[model samples]
Target chain A: MFNLIRRDFIIQKRQLVMYVLLILFFVLLGRQDPAFIFLLASIIIPVNTIAYDEKPETNILMNSLPYTRNEIIASRFLGTIVFIILATGVTSVLMYVFNRPFTTTDIAISSSLALFLLSLYLPMSYIIKPGYSAPTALISFLVLAGIVPPIVSYLGERLTSVTDFLLNLPVPIFYTSALLLGIVFYGTSWGVTTFIYRRKAF
Target chain B: MENVVEFNNVTKRFKDFSVKNIDLQIQRGFVHGFIGANGAGKSTTIKMMMNLLQPDAGEVKVFGMDYKTHEKAIKERIGFVYDANVFFENLNLKDIKRIVAPAYKHWDNTLFTQYVEQFELPLNKSIKNFSKGMQMKASLAIALSHHAELIIMDEPTAGLDPIFRRELLGVLQELMLDGNRTIFFSTHITTDLNRIADYIAFINRGQLVFNDSIHDITENYALVKGRTEFLDRDTEKAFVHINRLSTGFEALTENVSSVKRTFGDSVVVEHATLEDIMFHLKGGLQHV
Candidate 1:
């Protein structure tokens, strides 16, 4: 299973340098939100790895190996978490080196959002066709980014009581709840992917 | 167990195609050639053997263990090469090795290096840049490095030049020298099988036509040519399929002894090549 996860790094070794530059590019631009930059950083590697894995040949190769279908799915889910942390660490250092002002809350929000988006994206990748999953993920991400803020704000304006209650909660508790919610979604997605992949004939 | 892989009453159905009621046992320490025409469930049967596809109705066992409980254990002892390039095409062979080697408990770096050298495979070039033969050689190198007891290849020599095909067969023949490794490879190339295969499992229209030793295949199947009138209703039953030529009637018969007994001096009986059997039987059991 670890070898399966490690496969992403070996496959993307050349792209690693480009990933670092991508984060640096966003940081130096000094225009996007630090949280958004962090989220982008966290999402890139794992998602790119999925794009590599979405190929039929890759699935055939992996399934033919000594790894079980469950283990293969497990590796992707766990590898996502691992890459999220590594990406966060690298993004934080870049922010610091560039003298950009960012808080730990930014990291918290970005990582949680990254987890949420990936939770939805991972299983969908399995459900979608091989050559199209990566594009579907990108479009879905863009659509969500465009619509989510307006929807949330509209709800915030309309549902005053619920908004008031959520707003009244302590900041730490709110962030913690969001992080816990991300974990739950991720775990569920993991199970769903394993189930889908098990029945799949490669 | 004497059989390294067994499929008992196994059946898999696609929307328009199916492999039905296949009961095959691949014995240990011999090369078993799986031959079928295109889209004749050759890849489907191979996929089922590798556990890439599960039978809808029956059980598939490898090395005396069911895939449900022993997928990893079963796969550990088996090596597979698909018809297409299954490795990451962008990565060089060395990186591919790094990814694949740790997946096996018995991966021998020296053996892999030796195969790389023997096959003249470039470790630094990306797999996409390799020729078809090189890609096959690379797949073969990885499949052999782990000392797997069963090596399953799907059309391993499909696109190679004749010389490379012969070389690949020679390598497979060399691997058989240990008398401990079993190979089950699916190929429509019957000539390849004639050189190295000990047992031949022929599938036609999703049915197991026969699973017999090479000796049995040669002894049982023959192509007989005689005058057209000689192939009447009673004698016609002896042939799997009969081709009525202008000059005479040529047919494939599984019952070679019956052909000799019935025809006597009237007909000429010749050894049926694998290609001849496949060609005739491809018409789907036309006894008449």
Candidate 2:
């Protein structure tokens, strides 16, 4: 699994420089709303790296290796965490350098959304051809971004008792439960992708 | 001899074509040549062995272990080269080696470096810049570097010049001197296999037409050329595959003794080449 992740890095070595520049540029431009930059920073590199694997030869080369299909899927899931951490670090440092006013809530919301987006799209990339998968992933992201908040607000307004009960909980407990849910969702996505990949023929 | 690879009633189906009930056993310590025309399931069969393609039915076993259950263990001991290069074309040789070498437990850096030097591959240049033959050499270098017991190649000789093709055969010959490693490669070029292959497995139209020792094929089949008038209607039916020409006709026949006895000095008989066998067996319109 580590070797697979290391391969992704080596293949993207040329794009690594560009990744850093793009992260810094987005953070500085969206200083007022750091979540947009944070989301973009976390997801761009992993998604782009996934796109590189669209070629049939890469699949043949990978299957020819000794790694199990589960390990390959595990690597992608683990690599997403790696990407999330790196993106967060770069974004936090740039925010500090620019004296941006961003709270912990900003980081949590954006990172969780980024993770959710990744968990959704990674399986799609494996199940479908990469050419269709990449554009579909982006389109799905746009649709989610457009619809999710309004739906959440509408539910909050309609179910005041449920929303109030949740808002009244202790901050730590609420955050911990959200984090647990995110982890479960990510783990489930990993298993699902592995299952799909194991059955797929190159 | 123990078998290195076996396909028992293996089947794969697509909308238009399918490989049905292929039963092949590749014994250890020999060079096996897989020959076929275009779209003859050579690549499909190889893919199933490598577990790149799933067999709809039956099983593929490598090193006596089921491929699906022991893919990692079996693949570690097997090296493969595709007809077209399978590496990232944008990456240089060094980068590819770094990515791939760690996947195999028995990878030998010194051996890989030697091949790199022998093949005259540039470490820093991207593979996209290399010629087709150079790319093939690079693929062979990687396949050979892992000390793998079984090497499976798909048309490794195509696109290569005659000089390199001969050189590659020499390298395969040297690998066989150990008398343990098994080589399986598919090719349209019969001359490449004529020199080194011990067994030949011929597939045509997704069916296994012939699988035998090169010696047996050479011993059993003969090319018979004679005047068109010499081939009576009854005699023409004896040929495995016959080709007609304006003045004379050539045919491949297993009953060479009978043909020789009947035609006598009117016909010329010679040992059949692999190309002659493949061409005649393909059974198409006349070729000039």
Candidate 3:
């Protein structure tokens, strides 16, 4: 399973230099939040690797390996976590080097959001064509990010009863429940992707 | 002898095409050639064997274990080569070796190196830069080095020159010489199978036409050519596939004795090749 992860690195060797350059470029913009850089770096490699698998031949190559479809999906999920950790660690070191201000809260939020985003997108990528999935995910993420919060706040302003009920809840409970929901969603996405992949005809 | 692979009532359906009730058996220790035209169910069937595709009904078994239930175990012992390139094209041979070598428990680096040297494949050059033949040789090298008991190849020789195809077939024959390893090779090129395949399984329009020993198939089917006048209504019925030419009528038939009885000295009867058998099996719109 780690070999599957290693394969992604081998295939992405040429892109590693560009990724490093991006990290340096992001570092030069020292005022920019380190968490944002970490998030971007984490997603870039994995998303591109997934996009490269849009070719049916890559599916064939992966399926031809001795690993089960479940193992393959597990590797992808595990690889994402590893990438998130590495990206965060590297970015944290760079952030300290550049004297950029960031807290553990930023790391926690950025990493969790990356996982949540991946959980939402990776299954869609598996279900749909990679070429379509990557662009669709990006556009959808941008559109939702730009629109969802304002719409929610506007609805909250319009409906006091609904806003009051939500604002009354304890902060810790809300955070814990949201964390649990994210974990459940991520686990379910992994299961769904495995099921879809197992039945997929090469 | 134990059967290495078996498909019992396996069926796969697509929106427009389907392969149904495909029953096949491949015994151990022989070169089994799967012959079909393009778009036939040969690849589909092979995919099912590899568990790359799920069957709509029935089951596929490898090494007496269900393919789906024991996929890892089955795949570990089976080396597969696709008709098209399957490796990451941007990665070089060394990179591929690094990725693929660990997947198999019995992967032999010495054997892999020997094949790389034998095939004269450059280590550092990317697979995308290699020619089609070189790509196939690389695939074969990987497949062979794993010490896999069964080697499954789909159209592995489609792009190679005659010399390379022969050499590839020779390698397969050598693999089976020990009577412990087996090969399941799919191809549209029948002549390659004629030289090396012990058993021939022919599929057409998503159906198994015949699965028999090459010798038995050749013995059973014959090609007959005769003057047009000799192809009477009764004699025409005997031809499995018949073509009306300007000079004469040539037909293929399994009822060779009856055809001989009917035409006697008027027709020429000859043994059929795998290509001829496949041509005749299509039933119409194919000549020679």
Candidate 4:
């Protein structure tokens, strides 16, 4: 399974530079946005990586290998985790080198958000056909980004006191809750993707 | 006696066509030629035996183990090359060696390299840049280098030119020197099968017509061409398959010696080649 992941990684090694450049450009544009590079690494990279795989019909070749389907899926999931860890380390060094303003809280929040979002995205990408998946995922991201402002504005006035109470909670509780949510969502998505893989004919 | 590969009443359903209760067996040593028309479920059956596709109703066993439960065990001994190149198109032969070498415990990089040189495949060039024959040669090289006991190839002879085909057939003849090794394969070219295959498994319309030794299929069945009404009804029944034409009825029969005994010297009984036997068994054509 690790070998399979290594194969995917090596095949996509040429595209890694493009990803880094995209992140750097976005970071320059959205300097006000903390965790920009982490977002690019986690959410952007995993989905498009999967998209690249589907384009060449690599699944059939993967199927012909000795590995089982579940092993293949597990390898992808674990590979993403490995990539996230390595990318976060690299992005952290870059931010420090450039003297960018990013605290531990900001890193935790961004990484957790990317994890939650990408975890949900994976099962969708696997279950839906690739042609429809990319457009649909992009549209969903756009719609959510579009709606966030008004929802935050509306909730701010209506629940000012409640928001204050929740915001005043201990930092450890927040981190622990975020960690639990990431684990649960990722586990659920993994299960669903495994089901989809087993039922897939090709 | 354990066959290298066996499909015991396995059935699989596709969108448009279905394989119904396919029972196939290929023992060690001899090459088994799986012959069928296009979409006759030849590849489907092979895939089922390899456990690449699951059977809807029955079981498949490779090397005496249930394929699903012991797939790793089964795959360990079988080298498979499909009709298409199943490796990354942009990857080179060296990349393939790197990717696949770790999958098998007994992988021999030395032999693999030897094959690379022998087939004259460039080590560093992407497989996408290789010609069709070169790609097939690379596939064969990779399949053979693993020291597998059985090789299951689907249309391995399809796109090769006649000279290359003859070379491959000669290689297969040499591979059979290992008395314990076997090959079960499928191809549309009857001449290729005639050159090397010792056993023949014929399939038509998703049903297997018969499975037997090449000698048995050739010697037992005689192509009989004569007047339509000259033969009795039982003689017609004895034919494996017969098609009646405007001038006469064409037929193939298993009762060659018996028919000669019954008909005296008037009836014509001609020895059949593998092609003619397959043609008659599939459906004997009408005589002009």
Candidate 5:
């Protein structure tokens, strides 16, 4: 199972430099939110790894190996967490070295959002046809980005009592709850992907 | 004889095609060649053996164990090669080996290095740059390095130059030097089987026609030729299918003796090659 996870790194060895450069590009150029930059850094590697894995040939190769379908999916979910931590750590160091300002809150929010985005993307990648999932994910992310804020704000304005109760919660507890919710979604996505993958025919 | 793989009443259905009720057994310590035309469910059967595609009905077993309970154990003992390159195309052979070698518990690096040298494969060159033959050699090298007891390949010799095809056959023949190894490979090229295959399993149009020894297949099936007048409703029972030309008629028969007995020296009977058998059988069995 570790071998399966390590496969992503080996496959993308040449692109490792590019990944670093991509993060640096964002860090150095755009005046984007530090949290958003961190989110991009966390997402680049795992999502790119999926792009390679979504191919039929890759699936055939992985399935033909001694690993079970459960083990394969486990590696992907576990590997996503591993890369999220590693990429976030690396980005933090880069931010520190550049003397940029980022708080623990920034790390918390970005990592949680990373988990949420990936939880949704991983299962959808398996469900969608190969060569199209990346675009589908991009389009859906854009659509959600455009529409979700308005919906959430509208609901917040309409449901004052619920919004007041949530807003009254302590900051640490709120962030912790957000992180916990991300974990729940991640776990459910893992189960869903494994189910879909087990029934899939090569 | 110990059976390395078995399929019992296995059926897989697709909207447009299906592999119907197949019962096949592959013995240990022999080379079994699966021969069929394009879209004949050869790959489907091979995929079921690998557990890539589960059967809609019935069971498939390997090494006397079912896949549901022993998927990893079964796969660990069996190595697979598909019709196309399944390795990451952009990665070189060495990196690919690094990724694949650790998956098996008994991967032999020395044996892998030997095959790499023997096949003249470049370690640093990306697989995308390799020729079809080289890509096949790469797959074979990995499949062999694991010390797998059963090596299952689907269309390994398709789209290769004749020389490389012969070379691949020679490599497979050498692998058979180990008395415990068994090879099951599918191919449309019937001639390759004549060189090394000890048993032949012929499938046509999603149905298994026969899975028998080369000696039995050759002994049972033959080509009979004579004037068209020799073929009658009663006499036609001897032949599986018949082709009538303006000059004469040539037919394939599973019973060589019946053909001789019915014609009484009027028709010439010749040993049918694998091609002849496949060609005649592909025309659909005649019911007389």
Candidate 6:
């Protein structure tokens, strides 16, 4: 499985250099948006691979090889995580070198959030085709921002006393909670995608 | 029969076209020529047999194991190729080796080198720049270099020039020297099948029209060219396909002996070549 992920990652090696330029370009804006860069590329890079898969009509070739469809789909999921880890690692070094505003808490928070976003998107890709995944992703992104952000902000602002209490807890507790949430969403998404993929005739 | 591949009442549906019902069997140790016209559900059935697509209705088995249950193990021993260029456009042949080499633990780098040399494929050039024949060779090399028992190919030599097509078929013929090796190659090229296939299966519009050994088909099936009146209704029953010609009527059938007995002197019992057979099988259409 890791071999599959590694193969895909090697194919997408160009994206790495392209992403670094974007991160370095953004750094000149006077604020550390490595976290944002990390989040943005997490979705875009994987989708690009999926798009390339569609472009060359390579899925038929991949399907013929001695791998399960589930294994192939699972590789996409696992590959995204590997990319996220690499992106986060690169961004962390940049942040440390430039003495940026992204502290450890921000990195942890953004990383988990990116994983949740990836989980939500992974299944959409298989449910829909990759060619349409971009527009669908954009529409869904708007819907999420419309609904989730307000609800989250309301719970954070209106329930300030409780929120502040939890926020002020030892950072490890917050980190662990965030980590578990990310894992649950990822596992759930994997289950949903695998189910859909197995049942898909093509 | 120890068949390498079998399908039982399989059905697959696409929005515009669907394979209605399929029952197929290919025995181990002989090359089975899967002959079908374009869009005739040949690739679909092959895909199902290999578990590239799941059957909507029935079962597919390879090497005595259910395709669904033993997909990974089955895949490990089977190699497949499509007419389309499967490698990444940017990568050269060398890069493909680096990536796909690990997928099969039994993959032989030495054998790969031999195929490359035999096919005269370039080692350093990117595949995007390759001619259609070169691309086909590269894909075939990858498929053959893996230590696989069965090789499944879809339209492998459909569009290549006669020279390249023969070259490709020559390699397959050489591979068949090892009697343990088997192949199920699909193509519309009847001449190619005539040259190499031990058995031939003709599929038309998702239905298996005929499945038998190549020799049996060529000898048993006859194209009787005569008048409609020369052959009565009884004589026409065994004809799989018949059409009225200006001279008379031409019919295709497998029971050449019965046809001969019925109309001994009046009808010409021409031994149908694979081309003549597939022509009638595909509604007797004229094809290159």
**Per-prediction TM-score to the true structure, in the order listed:** 0.98, 0.95, 0.94, 0.92, 0.97, 0.92
Report, for all candidates in order, the number of backbone clashes: 0, 0, 0, 0, 0, 0
Local accuracy of candidate 6 as per-residue lDDT tens digits, A1-202? 8778877766767676887777766655645355565566456677676666554246666666777888988888888887777777777776667666676666676678778877887787776765887777778767875797689988998999989898798978877877887899899999998898777654
Instruction: Please estimate how well model 2 matches the true structure, expressed as its whole-model Cα lDDT.
Output: 0.89
In model 4, which regions exceed 4 Å deviation? A30-32, A52-57, A130-132, A148-162, B262-264, B284-288
**Runs off by more than 4 Å, candidate 3:** A148-177, B286-288
- Top candidate, metric lDDT: 1
- C-alpha local distance difference test of each model: 0.92, 0.89, 0.86, 0.78, 0.92, 0.79
CA lDDT, candidate 2, residue B262: 81
* Displacement of the residue B180 alpha carbon in candidate 3, Å: 1.2
The worst-scoring run of ten residues by lDDT in candidate 3 chain B lies at B279-288
As a TM-score, model 2 comes out at 0.95
* Chain B TM-score against the true chain B, candidate 6: 0.94
DockQ for every model comes to 0.90, 0.87, 0.84, 0.50, 0.90, 0.58
- Scoring the B chain of model 5 against the true B chain gives a TM-score of 0.97
- Model 6, runs deviating above 4 Å: A32-34, A41-44, A53-56, A138-155, A168-170, B284-288
Using lDDT as the yardstick, the better of models 3 and 6 is 3
lDDT of 5 at B35: 93
Cα lDDT tens digits, model 2, B1-288, are 899998999899999999999999999999999999989899999999899888999988999998657879999999899988899999999999999999999999999999999989999999999999999999999999999999999999998999999999998999999889999999999889988999999998888988899888988899998889877878887689888889788899977778877888788899999888888888845642
Chain B TM-score by candidate, in order shown: 0.97, 0.94, 0.95, 0.93, 0.97, 0.94
lDDT of 5 at B282: 90
Q: Which of 3 and 6 is ahead in TM-score? A: 3
lDDT (Cα, tens digit) per residue for candidate 5, span B167-222: 89988988899999999999988889998999999999899999999999989999
Model 2, docking class: high
Q: lDDT tens string, model 5, A49-132?
A: 899998999999999999999999999999999999988988898888887899998899889988999998999899899999
Q: For model 1, what is the alpha-carbon lDDT of residue B123?
A: 95
Q: How much is the lDDT of residue B131 in candidate 5?
A: 92
Runs with alpha carbons beyond 4 Å of true place in candidate 5: A150-160, B284-288
